[model samples]
Target: MGNNLWKDTWLMTVRNIKTTLRNPFSFIPNLIISAFFLLVYEGGLSGISQLPTFEGANYLAFILPVSIVSAAIGGAGGAGQSIVKDIENGFFSRLLLTPASRLAIVLGPIIAGMLQLVVQTLLIIGIAFLLGLEVVTGFGGILFVLLIAVGWGLAFAGYSAGVALRTGNAQAAQAGTFIFFPLIFLSTTFVPYDLIEAQWLKIAATINPTTYIFESMRTALIDGWVFWDLMQGVFAILIVCTITITFAAVSAKKAVSRG
Candidate 1:
């Protein structure tokens, strides 16, 4: 029975992908925007590593995780916006009438959104490597990065989608993007946590999950693979995924039942 549900989910996922690709303009802009930011960040950070805290690490290597996190968060918010669009066009209601399981309907948009994230992540990593970022942990480290990226993307998407379902308005759904930006920027992604002067920002960085994600990626890519660090990141990912997915599922069910 579970396998059947997942099979149905995959079919729904494929349909969602087709619907998304039908609007190339809607999807391509995000890739372009992410690429632009990747360039600016890598270029800006390349010259800043002479600072004592960098300790001779390649600036591109240092910033790669930041770019990944940005892309995932952006992609998740984009996914929520797409859900709003579907609601506006009555596509979601149409899906509700179909035999597809509720989980399938909920995960379909998420799967499509993850595909976009994967593309952005690959493009960013390629560009970073071109700028001389080296993966010290080799293939395994690269795999770890990809796993974290996917986990973060899914977790954020679930949270954003839950909010969209509850609000049932595109403009309100967009608040997730605004909320995510400060969280991303205030973390240790751009600057080392220890270097932060403001007590508040320092305290926030210590608590922000993005900091752990960046630290995990940095350790995987540059500092050699450490089991405990990877485990911490994995644990965080699982917790976020569980909470957000539960919220999304509940919200989606409520929305469907109300209709």
Candidate 2:
């Protein structure tokens, strides 16, 4: 059963990747959007380097993780959209009759999203290097940040896939992804947590999972490994992932029943 599960998941993951490559239009726009954010911050927000949050560090470096995080979550949007497409076309129904592992059906697309997130992260980092942002953690740090970013993408993808399974509607999946943006935006995204003076905003940021993820990424990129600090973010990820995967599992089972 274990071998079958792994094989099924791997094959489904490969299928999702192939489908994505064949239709680049599905998710390429997400990378473009992330690039736009990175560029805007690089040019327009350079002045924020003086803010207490950054404390004289290059603004681009401080916000690079923000842009990467944006891209990571965008991958989930892509996953959700794909699931909707599958559901709309009766593809999911066919899969339900197959001998494939049930969880694999849901997880395969998410693993693809993780791959997308990791690749996007590397490209963004390369762009940063080109634009004169120094990577303080080097190759090891690059790998570390990639793992962290991909974990985030997988976690968020669970929520996205959950919504897609529940609604089976493209628009709902897209809207749900939009809802994810504000939570991260409200957090200490633009500045450090200590610099946030607004009490309500600070509290929201404190509670947001991405805040810890962003802080951990920043630390990995600029401050070194710091396992203890990174674990907080990991814990947040586990919580979010657990909740969403559970939701997705339930929704998927419901979908099977309805079909």
Candidate 3:
């Protein structure tokens, strides 16, 4: 049974990846938006680095991780949107009739989406480097940044997938991802937590999981390895994943029964 699950997952994952590749329109927007944010923010907010607290800091490097992390979180909508299409066109119902393990079928697209997100993150990072952004931790930081991106991507993909499975509405699935947009901006997107003078926003940023993840990647890019900060990011990812994955699993089961 375990071997069959693995085989089913691999086949489904391959199919989903192939489908995504065949239809470039599905993911091109994500890449474009990520790159656009990186360029716009790096250009517009570059002066933020001139502040006393940011002395000698390169704003592009400081904000590079923001683009990577945002891509992971926002890029997940593609998975949900794809699933909604499957549900709409009756593909999901047909797949449910197969002998494939339900768990494997549910996991396949999420994993495929995560792999896509990782690639996007790498591409964005490469662009940043081309734009003169430098990582203090050098090449090793890329690995760490990828790890964090994967965690967040997987979590959000699962959450998005859950919404798709439950609603079977493309717009709802896509709109569900938007609910997180505020989380992105409410955090330390513009400035560091300590430097954020707005008391209310600072309070929100303190409790925001995005802040920890951002700081973790920032540490890798600008401050070198900080074991504590990285671990905090990992813990935050795990917590979010725990909620999102459980939601996905339950939604998958419900979807199967409804079909």
Q: What's the lDDT for all of these models?
A: 0.80, 0.81, 0.85
Cα lDDT tens digits for candidate 2, 153-184: 88788788889989999888878987766756
Per-residue error for 226 in candidate 2, Å, reads 3.3
Mark the regions of model 1 whose C-alpha exceeds 4 Å error after superposition. Answer: 1-4
lDDT of residue 191 for candidate 3: 82
- Where does candidate 2 stray beyond 4 Å? 1-3, 51-53
Please report the TM-score between candidate 1 and the true structure: 0.91
Provide the TM-score for each candidate, comma-separated: 0.91, 0.91, 0.95
Worst 10 residues of 3 by lDDT: 69-78
- Cα deviation in Å at residue 236, candidate 2? 1.4
TM-score of model 2 vs. true structure: 0.91
- Per-model clash counts, in order, read 0, 0, 0
Residues 1-259 of candidate 3 have per-residue lDDT tens digits of 4449889999888998999999898888878888998999999999989988875788998888778877787567667877888899999888888878888777778878888898899899999989998888888988998999899888888889999999999878878987677668888887887788889998888888888888898888888888997788899999999999899889989998854
Query: Which model scores highest in lDDT?
Result: 3
Q: Tens-digit lDDT track for model 1 on 117-143? A: 887788888877787778889888988
Candidate 2 clash total? 0
> What's the residue-level lDDT of 60 in candidate 1?
75
Candidate 3 Cα errors over 4 Å, as ranges: 1-3
